[model samples]
Target: MNANIIIECKDLGKQYKTPEGERVIIERMDLAVKENEFVVLFGPGQCGKTTMIRLLSGLEQPDRGAVRINGKRIQGPGPDRGVVYQTISLFPWLTVMGNVEYGPKVRGIAKKERREKAQHYIELVGLKGFENTYPVKLSGGMKQRVGIARAYCNEPVVMFMDEPFGALDAQTRYLMQEELAQIWEKEQRTVIFVTNNIEEALYLADRIIVMRNCPSSIKREYEIDLPRPRNYVDPEFLRLRKEITGIMDKTL
Candidate 1:
């Protein structure tokens, strides 16, 4: 493994047993993500992008090959990886502070220390004044913010975001994208983000890995060299978007 590569997977494969037959989702996939690099896995629906994230994050075991993190084989979930899902699942009963501090609290960090750390993350995610607010009161975007803060509080070496803004309204989605970019700039982490939206991928990723239709494998990889806070209307951005879209499998 390269010293700069925080996560690497070689010839990884996965399949599920269905009543019809075995369904292969990933095949002969190999990838290496460098430290603090934000990589986006972009592909058509049901192309196994989520499955790739699961395998890399140790949420699901691959049928063949292996995933390594920091030169060690990934056996299962550990503190080094954190995940933010499309649907925000905050503890309804817990306040923003409570939910953000939950991970450290469970790990037995001192209350004062954990709260301070959680407070910092809460502020980082633009939720400073909402410490006592419960999830029920938060708008969809705010809820996701809390979710991000909670994940960041754990100080994971890598963050796996599976279409984290997919559920939001278009305006909210755009806002969240900008906010996420700012957050990443402030505190860098190795992030593997899965998204079907080309604009979102272009805006957030340092590199975009396009996957083939299931049983998915890398179709192509693009290094996005655009300046930060990308404009959707930029000529180069639009050109790349059209080119990538042209190669994607059309969904029925």
Candidate 2:
């Protein structure tokens, strides 16, 4: 409940009834995210990374413990948190401008004001010229751009991204990672991004939390002190990457 800590997950635990039996996905996990901190949740196996995000973001309730944002316990999903998913869930019928403005529009923001705000975010995500384009016509990376813009247009206090770039091709994935890092640099937000990609995690994260698989908990944490626009092949970067990989390799 510190002033600078925008997010807190205390002794969080969750269980699900599976076909086999009751399955525990999270186990008494504790986490705190500082204001405007970019944190990545990385793991080797199918840790409950997504489940943790859902619980924290209020998409699901933990059977025990709590998730707090700004010292208040989360009850359910709200505008203060914006989420981008692996599927790039854009409105197929809506154009880029329409989709980005959807949240504001639903919240009764005036058309002119929302349009101006939407335009700013659209340009910010490098999609100014494609305002009229629909999701069906855009490429994978471009659609994710729209997703990011749409999330930003809400002006959320925290952004929870669950593998937003996981499905992209390698070249496009790398490009999107670079672009996302640049975007985060310009517009700082408390971002909790989940991914299994170590390079992507290192490139974008201010701190990386390595999690243990199924019945997950934080195994290790690394504060990345390297400068922005980090080089993948930099010796220090490689060394850290190797160290992280070695740590997670045990979970396999």
Candidate 3:
């Protein structure tokens, strides 16, 4: 598919006021995310990766500059951009279907239509038989799948995910990673994922954006030129992983 710009962040900067003084987190960051692209922002904790995601999703405004989605300015969170957080921030009280339908319902979609839409994503995330289960009844990985279903149910143009698999155990994380790849392969929505895991970033991203330390900026971009169903032991894949790990180790 030909790449077209779907999201643009220009001179995006963000700061927080500390008791001591103002602490700059991101500065003059310019990024363009093409449609149907899977881009990962890789950095250690507190390195402003999530902050950048929030900025792009319009959850928080930048201290300076702006985020534009398909040539239109993003003023605040809308149904067009959906987000999944590291913690699987689902409402404990809502059932799986309820959670998935929340977005469309809030947007005034009719009850029957929202239910059908939610069911579509529930099935898409492989939770068809567990539609009525509450968050508390689900496993960690299951809960994250609900979050993914909820995000996709609204048919968002872009999906911003912050370490959606971070909380799962090693085995579960790997399973979820493969599942995510399958979902993205079928759906083909623009995804901006944030993670500190170099391997995870490489496995899921078409391009990886490596960010610098506080007052963060894009340091390097690795366009993963590997074939689908990429083998971990492939020479090129291994080389890129080692190279990215070296850069991360140096920065940390």
TM-scores, all candidates, are 0.98, 0.98, 0.95
Q: After superposition, how far is residue 182 of candidate 3 from its true place, in Å?
A: 0.2
Q: TM-score winner among the candidates? A: 1
Across residues 155-251, which tens digit of lDDT does each residue of candidate 3 receive? Answer: 9999999999988899999888888999988888999999998878888889998888877998888899788767768898889999988877244
> Which candidate wins on lDDT?
1
For residue 150, give model 3's deviation from the true position in Å: 0.4
Predicted candidate 2 versus true structure: per-residue lDDT over 87-190, tens digit per residue: 88888899999999999999999999999999999998999899999899999999999999999999999999999999999999999999999998999999
Return the lDDT, model 3, position 9: 85
Scored by lDDT, model 2 comes in at 0.93
Candidates in descending TM-score order: 1, 2, 3
Q: Is candidate 1 or candidate 3 better by lDDT?
A: 1
Q: What's the residue-level lDDT of 67 in candidate 3?
A: 93
Cα lDDT of candidate 3 equals 0.89
- Deviation of model 1 at 163, angstroms: 0.5
Q: After superposition, how far is residue 54 of candidate 3 from its true place, in Å?
A: 1.5
